[model samples]
Target: MSLLEQLNQDMKQAMKNKEKDKLAVIRMVKAALQNEAIKSSHAELSNEEELTVLSRELKQRKDSLLEFKNADRLDLVEKTQAEIDILVDYMPEQLSEEEVSEIVKQTILDVNATSKADMGKVMGALMPKVKGKADGSLVNKLVLQQLS
Candidate 1:
């Protein structure tokens, strides 16, 4: 099923199960996706567009999780973590660190990226292949490691 369809089904299930946290997160993400669709010229988002929205949402939660932890806000941290967990359920299967590294290495080669200066070239050619499959920070780290 498409992500939107799956989200709709899960939202119904969450409501039936009385899973408040899950339902809230699903609704929030659904709204975000819909807003992105409206922002663009099209009314329906393509798979890539949906993935982009998903990635942005996940990244926002991860950033908040870090900030919450750093501030020693245990309660907020827990809530944010639960939200993250819920969002993750809708994400694509993640690529492993080794797998991402290998792809980064190949991307470097494909772009002829020999040094840090060529990082942009490497990443430009790489993000499309790895988007929604791996963490951005992990990919950036691997690309830097490979180039320098």
Candidate 2:
């Protein structure tokens, strides 16, 4: 099933099980997806578009998680972390650090990226291959390590 279909099925199950947190997350994600679709003037989103929306949602929650942590707000931190956990369930399986590093190494070579000057070239060619699968900062770190 597509992401939307899977979300619908899980939403129904969450309701049946009285899982309020899970249900709420699912509904929120659904609304985000629908909103994105409407913005793009499409009735249905392609897989790439859905992934973009999911990533945006996940990133927002993660940023919130970081701010909450910095402000020492344990309550908000925990709440944001829980929301992040729910968002992750719908994301593609994350690429391991090792796996991402290997891909970074290969991409660097493929693009002939020899120094930090080529960071843009390497990343432009790399992000499409790893988008939604690996963390951006991790990818940037790996690429910088390889380049420098």
Q: Write the per-residue lDDT of candidate 1 for residues 71-99, one digit (tens) a residue.
A: 99999999999999998888899999999
> Which pairs of residues have clashing backbones in candidate 1?
none
Minimal lDDT window, size 10, model 1: 105-114
lDDT of 2 by residue, 1-148 (tens): 8999999999999999999988988999999999999999998999999999999999999999999999999999988899999999889999999999999999999998899999999999999999999999999999999998
* TM, every model: 0.98, 0.96
Model 1 spans with C-alpha error above 4 angstroms: none
For each candidate, the alpha-carbon lDDT, in order, equals 0.93, 0.94
Candidate 2 TM-score, true structure as reference: 0.96
**Model 1 residue 131 distance off true place after TM-score fit, in angstroms:** 0.3
Give, for candidate 2, the lowest lDDT window spanning 10 residues.
Answer: 78-87
